[model samples]
Every structure is written in structure tokens, then in C-alpha cells.
Target: MLFLKPPGVYAPQDDTSLLTTALHEEPLAPGARVLDLCTGTGALALAAARRGARVTAVDTSRLAVLTCRLNARLAGARVRALRGDLLGAVPDERFDLVLSNPPYVPSPHPQLPRRGRARAWEAGRDGRALLDRICSEVADRLRPGGVVLIVQSAFSGVAPTLDALVRTGLDAQVADRRYVPFGPRLRERAAWLRTQGLVAAGVEKEELVVIRGEAAL
Candidate 1:
């Protein structure tokens, strides 16, 4: 489905495509509840809706929320797009599946961006700021047997994510991985990332991994 990406809204990129592919592989039943956190253009949400699941998409950016809503309408898919942060968007909702392609690029700054295009990728130093929160809180948002598919850079510590999810009582593992060339942001941060030991010197590519965590029945 074609999505309208306005200025400041994150366009669907490698990580997004990878997560969407993983979402398609899941055994989603009709009317199953699904939530797409940090949803940018509602790509995964729309994908689930196309498969007959009820979908809700949440993002921290207003532009992202608007873009997702518009894209959902154009695709003739039902999606509830809301502007809010992580699990806080739908506090009372539980889902059979949760999808997120959140910001995972480690930034030089410790504080996250409050607005602008940077919010799409400028994660705090170590890059696990949002990833950690999601791992810790998402299980509570899942119905028994529900699953979450989250894509993040291997630079952001994939093993820790799996460990956290397991600590939450979910069966977790690395579901998919792809080596993608550094994007403009990562390329710009290459020197800094090297200095921080997050990447090897002269490395121009990063490994992205999709971690799948399934809530126990």
C-alpha cells in the first residue's frame, strides 16, 4: 500500500520493511487485536489490518500520527492512529500482537529529541532507551499468548532485548536479521559511534535484528 509521508514523519525504511515481513509471517487470526507502537506511516498496522486484524497505531509525533491516519484511510484499512508515547497511548488495551520499529540509533546526546525529524532516529546514548522500556512494559500489554515483534540495530544490544523479554516471562528469540548500509543519520554518526565502540572503525554497515517475544499462554 502506498503511504503518504509528510515532512518530519519517518518514511518506511529497511527496519520497517523487515518488521512488516515478520508481521506477515505471524499467524494472525481475523479480528485479533494488534498494536503498532512507534508506528511511523502505519505500515505494519495497515499490513495487519489487511489480514483482518483490528489495528491501533501509536506514535509520539503529531505529523507521524496524521500521516498514518491518512495512509490508513487511503489504503481502505481501519487503523486507530494516536499521538502519544509507547504503551501509554492505549493504556487499557491488550493485544494479540504488538509491532514496533522504534528509534535505535545511538546518539551522542543522552537526552532524546523533543521534536523534529531527529525524533525518528536519535535514541539516547547506548540506544536502548526506548527499546528497554518496550521490553519491560510490553508484556503487560499482551494477552496471554500474544507476541511482540521489535526491530532494532544489533548495535543497540540484541541479546539484552531477548534477555529482558525472557525475564518478563515471554519466550523470545531473534526472528530475523539483515545487514543494511548505514543511512544518512548513521553515516553522520559513524565517527562518533566508532569512538563509543558501538561499531568497528571504518565499518559502514550495521546489522538490524527483529526480536520476537511471545507471551506464555
Candidate 2:
């Protein structure tokens, strides 16, 4: 799907390819229990709910949570939107499938568009803050044979992400990818793109890497 939107947009246009692929790959499957992490605009949860899944979406921003709740109500989907960072806000619970499109931009700039701790596009100090944490905790929060799907950017390269998830004992796979144009920080990622054979071809350093893996049983 195309996820086009205005620049510096607070929320993403689409729910990311991982969500769409997950829906196509596994789908709601009757009464599936789903968890959507960092649900910026509730797209995944709402979509899954439409497919007959009971979804609970969590975000760190109150505005995001409210937006999602309102959208869910409007769409007549049984989706719960809660405000919380990562998995803290929700009570103890497990789901058949867990999904997230966490903040993946790695930046050295102090002043970013969304500067809030959890709302920022990139995790602070090497950009591995939230991704690492999520990988480490997913195994425990997931049920037996549960699936964990995350959409991370290849900004800093996919190797780091693959290594980290593998280190967490999850068998990772790149389910899908998309080439996006550089919006704000095009120059910053030029060198990295060159290594990936993207820059010399006039392609910008914007891309999405969707990963799928099951929690250790």
C-alpha cells in the first residue's frame, strides 16, 4: 500500500507494510487477540478489528490515544486505545499477535519534529533504545507460538536490527520493504545509502524494513 502524507506529519499515513502483510499472512483468524504497539493513529488496530480481531492499541501520547479511541468508535470497531510507553500502560496480558512500527529514525539533531520522549521519530543515543527494549521483552509478553511483527527502518542498516532480534532469540525474517524518499535528513544518510548501492543510483536513503518472528516457545 502507498503511505503518502504531508511532510513533518505527526502520525503516519498508513499503518506500515508489516500490518498489511500480517493481515494478509495471518489475518484476524476468527477471534484473534491482537496488540498494536506505538499505534500512532490506530490504523492497524482498527483494520484488524474490522477483520474480526479483538485489538488493543497502545501509544505514549495522550493525543494519539484519544485519536485512536475516537477513530475506533467512529469505525464501530471493538478496539481499546490506551496511553502508555511501550508495554507499561497496559495491564498484564498476552496476545496471539503483537505488532509495532516503533520510532526508527536515528538522528544527532537535538531538535526534532516530535521531541517528546516516546513520540519522537528516533530513539535517543544510537536509536536502539526502544527497539532493543521491545525485542528483549517480546518473548515474555507473547503467548506460546505468538507472532511478533515489527516495522523498522533500514536507516542505520538492517544488520543491527537483525542481530539484535536474533540475540533476543527470535527467528527474524524480512517480510517486506519499500523505498521512500528522503524528507528532512537526506544528507545525513547519504554515506550509509552509498554502502547499500542506493545513493549512486540517485535513490534517497529512505526505506522501511518489516520483520516477522515468533516468540520463543
Candidate 3:
């Protein structure tokens, strides 16, 4: 699971591990087309490629895209790493499976960061800025009977995510859950989150959920 993570590129952590586990648990057919959105270090992308899936990873950060490509080359895995906003690089392409570990951490900032490492994790007040958009658009990219696995913090509201996917005519539900200690980012915002009622006082852990959405045949 170790990969080259440049200074500015996001290093895979707990959430990444959780999503990677889910990726392994899912049934993946050989040669299945897979798309990894907000691919970060492309850890999940590499995993899929190892499973014989045709993987394409997308990230807004140039560092991340380069890191993914180099990692894939070193691992001898074939992966197409592209630099672009989520789904923007392959608007006309459809996939048999899609994976995303997007930003779902609520932030005091109202707007998403246009530059820097913050772009990998800051997703506005509700943390749904990117999540909502992905839910709305991912269904379109999914081939019939395709599935998408998305990992996010429960603080971002799981119900809304399921509802959003259902509205898009996909069956969505929580596929996996884990409780982990807050990372530095969440720990720094603990007090603010408490004030916003997103976190309780003295609570040092957050729940991460992997939501699965499946398109109908």
C-alpha cells in the first residue's frame, strides 16, 4: 500500500485504507473499467489495476496525478492518471465501477481552496460541496448495473447521500463503517465542530462510512 507521496500530494491515511478494504471486498471482474475520482496518491487505483481492472484515476492536484502515474509505473500496474476536476477528464466515458474518497470534512471556510494541499480535504461548511455534486453526476457515468463506492465521514450526513443517490435512480446505502481517532485536521476543528453541533464535547473519534450506490440494469 506504500506509494510515493510528494510533499504537496495527499498521503493515504485511515480513510484511504478503509476505501481500499472496501475495494477488495467488492466483486471486481477482470478487465472491468474502473474510475477513481479525487484519486490522491492513486492507492485505490493501483489496487484496482492489480485486480485486473482497467483503471483511470483523476485528481485536481498536479502532484497527485504525477505521483499516481509514477507509482503505477513502479508497481508495473497499468493505470491512466489524469489531472482534472472529478469526472471532468472523462465526461463521455462510462465505467463499470467508480471509486471516490472525496473531501467530506466540514470546514469553517465557505469556499473550497483553489490551490494547495487543502484542496484535497476542505469541502465547505457542510462538507457536501463536492459530495453532492459527485452523487448527482456519478450515476450518469456508471454503466447499467455499475456500482460506485464512496467513502466519507458520517458527520457529513449519510442519509442525504443515500437520498441523493436514490434520487438519481440508484440504490444507495452504507456499505461499511469504522470509528477512528480524529486526524490532525479534525482535531484542530474539534472545538468549532462542537459549537456547530457536528461533534460532541469530549468526543475524539469520528465515524467514517463507505457508501455504495448501484445503478439498475
**Highest-lDDT candidate:** 3
How close is every model to the real structure, measured as TM-score?
Answer: 0.98, 0.80, 0.98
Please provide the root mean square deviation of candidate 2 (C-alpha atoms, Å): 4.2
| Tens-digit lDDT track of model 2 for 1-217 | 3322222324653326455666668745788888999887677777788888889998877667777787787777899888887877666888888888777666554343344543547665355667877887776677777888888767655777677677777787887887766755446656654665545766664677777877667
The TM-score that candidate 1 achieves is 0.98
The number of clashing residue pairs in each candidate reads 0, 0, 0
* Residue pairs that clash (backbone atoms under 3 angstroms), model 3: none
lDDT of 1 by residue, 91-209 (tens): 98899999999999899999998988999988899999999999999999999999999999999998899999999999999999999999999998899999888888778998999
- What do the candidate models score in CA lDDT, each in turn? 0.92, 0.71, 0.94
Q: By summed lDDT, which 10 consecutive residues of candidate 1 come out lowest?
A: 1-10
Segments of candidate 2 deviating more than 4 angstroms: 1-9, 14-18, 110-118, 185-205
Ranking by TM-score: 3, 1, 2
